[model samples]
Target chain A: MRVLGIDPGLTRCGVGVVDVEPNRTAKLVDVVVLRSPADLDTPNRLVRIADGLEAIIDEHRPQAVALERVFARSDVSTIMGTAQISGVAMLLAARRRLPVALHTPSEVKAAITGYGRADKAQVGAMVARILGLEAVPKPADAADALALAICHAWRTGGVAGAAVTDASAPAPLARTTTPAQQAWLAAERSAAVSGAARRLKK
Target chain B: MRVLGIDPGLTRCGVGVVDVEPNRTAKLVDVVVLRSPADLDTPNRLVRIADGLEAIIDEHRPQAVALERVFARSDVSTIMGTAQISGVAMLLAARRRLPVALHTPSEVKAAITGYGRADKAQVGAMVARILGLEAVPKPADAADALALAICHAWRTGGVAGAAVTDASAPAPLARTTTPAQQAWLAAERSAAVSGAARRLKK
Candidate 1:
């Protein structure tokens, strides 16, 4: 499944697209940082960002969108703009009939770096390593967007697989699983184990 | 000049339209509150509000939009939704090539009532009186929306007239005003004075 991730803002909005496989591997499709001038009024700035997002969604045609949920920060001024752009992003996704999932910053960091308190550099490094890129995506927001996409894909059970895997708890068995689904889950578990081993080795 | 005023929210968005003349008289064009169900997801709720706002703008064809500016409040949860809807309103206005102006709650209140910190009932009473309505618009948001429209119209000078008038200082002479513009400004000043006198009598 192709997932589009967005780190929304007024001045700079980062967008990344990735395809996740049933075995829990992710490949980068595209990444971009859309920007609007600071001197422009809020309305025009919103329009520019909205247009950029629309173009990206049309070009990639991602099945789902993963957005960075905005929180009210100490910086009251910037938070409003962040929330505004996020709204625009969500509206665009709804217009195209794509499902949207919002992931908090800490959630994205923990998913990518195994620590919710990890710094930007650690998350960026992990994102680069996961996508097998030679260098981390620039501007921090770009790497964050990619991490959001990977996190959503993994949390939702790889491409089309079912049931979230909790490290501390056994899988719930209320619903029956087909043989094909079981096999896919097994493959996913193995892949996760091997991926952790490789990271430990590095 | 026709102005559409919006009190944006995810659950209930208030919209009001009015036409203001050169003499600062405002006539109600239309007023309504758009609502989305609380059970709906954030994305769909946003879509519903956007559609409602778009339809109103298309139908009214207002020359300017006056949206209530959202502020960070003690209630953090509601602020995000307010900011989001405000963004949508601004975007809609921009798409139609109409100028959008954001007025704070105090600004709207002060514009309608003489006191900046006037309570809701006071502002509502003033809005009804200004528009010559029989009663205050129901659901405070509706009256607030009309207040926003009247405020914008008055602040910008009635029906596309001249520079902003200051109660504390003389009008800036930076730009030359035509004879017709001067006449409009004089009429606006007299209307403001008479309006204040009427309110004082009440």
Candidate 2:
């Protein structure tokens, strides 16, 4: 199933799509960041965001869309704009009859990094490693969107995939490797970096 | 000019419409309450609100729409839901290209009651008097919506139809009797009350 995950914001709404096969491996389909500047009037900006989502849905045709369910937030400043973007995502998805799943931020972190408390750096590294990409996605919002896609795939992927297991835990512990693994890891890094550059060009 | 005012909410969205002629005296056109039950999910509720707004626009064909500008409140509980509804209202208005105007709560209060901090009772009484209606519009949200409409008309309307002038401010202060005040006031109360009851039935 192909899933589209959106990290919604008024100025920078990020979208990332991933295809998760029966075997539980996920392939990065595409990622983009859309912006509606603060200076623009609210209605105009909202319409732009909705139009952008329409294009993304038409281009990607994801079977499902995952959004960060808006929570009651004490920080009123960012929540309004964020919720507005989130509202657009929800309305459009419903209009298209696409099944919608809402995941909390902690759920996303746990799914991506096996630690609900994982920081942005940890989530970014895991998104890169799991997707076999060269470097982390640029602009934190993009990485976050990709992370959301990966999270959905892992959480719903059945026995072959899991949300977060203690075994796959934090990255610092994953660093300990055998001598044979050390050399293999170095080679894999160089190949993946070059391959990522070539793939990104497309 | 005809104006539609929206008091946005998740479960209950209130709508009111009024027409102001060249002389500035306003007449109530219609009022309605739209619902998306709490038992229902978020997206479905949002669509219901949008559909209700569409119907209102089609039936009334208001020249302009007024919305309660979403505010940042310390209370986080209902703000997200309220803001989402507000966002939906804005988007629909934009889609129809019906000139959207947002008024803050205090601004609406001040326009109608001549005091930005006027309590609900004062606003309700003033709305009924200003629009030539009988009784307060039920469900505070609906009354609030009507108040919003009156605010827009008075604030932007040409000199003749002002809701309440700063000089003649406050319900009690504006209660001065003209030559025909006693008989006219009595007739107006009886006639308007019965007329309102029949209008509401339809």
Candidate 3:
């Protein structure tokens, strides 16, 4: 199966394609990026992003779409902007009826490098080395998008796990629970965030 | 001066190095990744991360360090773990007195790709193309961490703005000011987040 990973941005969104082999191996196929103007209105920007996503999907024909999950930032505008971008991505994938999976940025790093803290160059090198390529991926976001796809492939057992160094690492996160569970968990997070925000306000 | 970018995880931490010439051009030098045992406890896991960071710094001797800033996660456990890893990165950089800059994932992505919404593969491709490399960087996290360093170089005008694209296409984000101004406005983001949290609670 071919998987497409997206790093959605309002101005500059990244797209990467990885083909997963029957033996559970993934190889990089292509990466495309476009930068939108900063001055566009929000709806216009989303349209631009949707256009980019459509172009990528048309070109790559990926069977599945994997996205990096949203993490809360201290900046409201940044967080809102990211959510809007993410929403666009989800809408695009859902429109195509493609199965979508979300991975945290840390999960992607950990899955690719066996180190959650690995940097971009390290991830590029690992991707290159894993595929026995001549060099690492460029334009870091492209590489990250690829990594997200790869991580999904690995998670789904579509790729060989032995090559991933942290195959035995404890699950970095809990398994998928019910919406109720998720809500409860999120409530705790909301409380923590609120507490921190209140403290920062002072 | 060479700057090493690190993405820290309990089991795997990605590392990447780029030589930032006096002229502000960043050339990829090396990327390394280390994997720790999956079952190690919190303290031991931190030690593993610390050791890996030290080793990378010693081998690369980077003049500075750049990392993706931690954001709040709904999972308290995950957030705490991320903070711990961040602390480990900070400690290693501090030991060497290397100036460390923390960037949000979007900032790093924006710096590397023209759009903050750019995906991982696009970022990787950009990294490769900008650095004049032939292939996408591997293990994606390494590439992203490295991108953070590259973004810093670009933002500091080290590359004379060569690192970022000027696509000027309509972006999904609605920014009223230039990115430089947007960056300066981040200080107020904390307050905005706090207010949003309050509104969400009601």
Candidate 4:
């Protein structure tokens, strides 16, 4: 199966596609970086990234899409840009009906280098070796994308768990809940939101 | 001019459209809340939101889109969901070539209630009065969306600064920089990202 992995960001988004076999071996199919200059307005920058992903999807046609999960920023400043990019990436995958997975930074490191705490160089070298590349991918972000794809492939074994990954793809979210249970949960959320909004008014 | 204002959240996204006359009198056009269950998987919930926003835009045919600017969450957990929803809303506006604005909560409060730190009830009540409604919109989130639209209309004086906002719309994030300076700043960002990525791997 083929997987497209995205390390999403506002100024720079790293994307890589990989082909994985049942034996768990993975090969890098393609790698590219999507960058929107900081001077660009937010909407246009997001559009550029979304458009870039569309081109990649059309070109590689990966069976699944994976992304680096959004993490908290050290400051309040960087959160929106990261989340916006992450949101756009998920939307793109859903639009194409492709399954999506989100891996934490440590998840990528652990999958690629066998250590969740591995530094960037260690992860890069491991990703290079696993993909049978002569050198680590240029631009560490791109290598990180490759690491994410490899991680998703190794963790899910590709193809089989894709439906679970894409909550929009007719798979159960929690797997254990019945439709009735889900309906109850929905009602609970509605009540909670209304309650929260009401309380805030006081 | 008509404005579609979005109060973005993963659990409940509030959207409202309003018409602003030349004299700055505003009339309500439409209001609705798009809700996703907590039990729903993330991607599917996002798709539900993106689809809902698309329908709202097509139906209302608003000339501009506005939303509450992403703010730092006290709890941290809510930031990604809010930012992602915000991103999708902006992407929808960009796709349709509509101008978009982001109003801070305090700005909305100030616009509607004559006080920057006014509570939600005060803003909602003022929104009803401004739009000439008998009562505030049902479901506080929807009221909040209207407040956002009203804020944008009042602050930018409707269609006059739209071209500026939209240019800032397609491109800007920080919302404070001029275009030329933003471009130079973007170059600096490019250098910084490359530098940061390189250093991480070393």
CA displacement after TM-score superposition, residue A131 of candidate 3 (Å): 3.6
Off by over 4 Å in 4: A162-202, B160-202
lDDT of 1 by residue, B164-201 (tens): 22111223222335566556555655664467634644
Of 1 and 2, the candidate ahead on TM-score is 1
The recovered share of true contacts, given per candidate in order, is: 0.67, 0.43, 0.00, 0.72
Candidate ranking (TM-score, best to worst): 1, 4, 2, 3
Q: Is candidate 2 or candidate 4 better by TM-score?
A: 4
In model 2, state the lDDT of residue A15.
89
Q: Sorted on lDDT, highest at the top, how do the candidates line up?
A: 1, 4, 2, 3
Candidate 2: pairs in clash: B24-B161
A1-202 per-residue lDDT for model 1 (tens digits):
8889999989889999999886667899999999988767788899999999999999999888888877779987689889889888888888787877777787676566666676888788878888999999999989989998887777665543232221111222223245665565456446644674246436
- lDDT tens digits by residue: candidate 4, A1-202: 8989898888889999999987678898999989998876788889999999999999999888888877677865466787898899998888888888877887677556655677787777777877999998878889999988887776664554443453233323344345654564455346533553234334
Best by DockQ: 1
The DockQ-based order of candidates, best leading, equals 1, 4, 2, 3
Estimate every model's Cα lDDT from 0 to 1. 0.78, 0.71, 0.62, 0.76
What TM-score fits each model? 0.84, 0.77, 0.42, 0.81
TM-score of chain B of 2: 0.76
DockQ per candidate? 0.38, 0.21, 0.01, 0.32
> What's model 1's lDDT at B196?
66
* Consecutive 10-residue window with the lowest summed lDDT within model 3 chain B: B160-169
- Candidate 3: regions farther than 4 A off: A159-202, B1-202
Off by over 4 Å in 1: A159-202, B159-202
Local accuracy of candidate 3 as per-residue lDDT tens digits, B51-89: 677887888787667766656567634554555465456
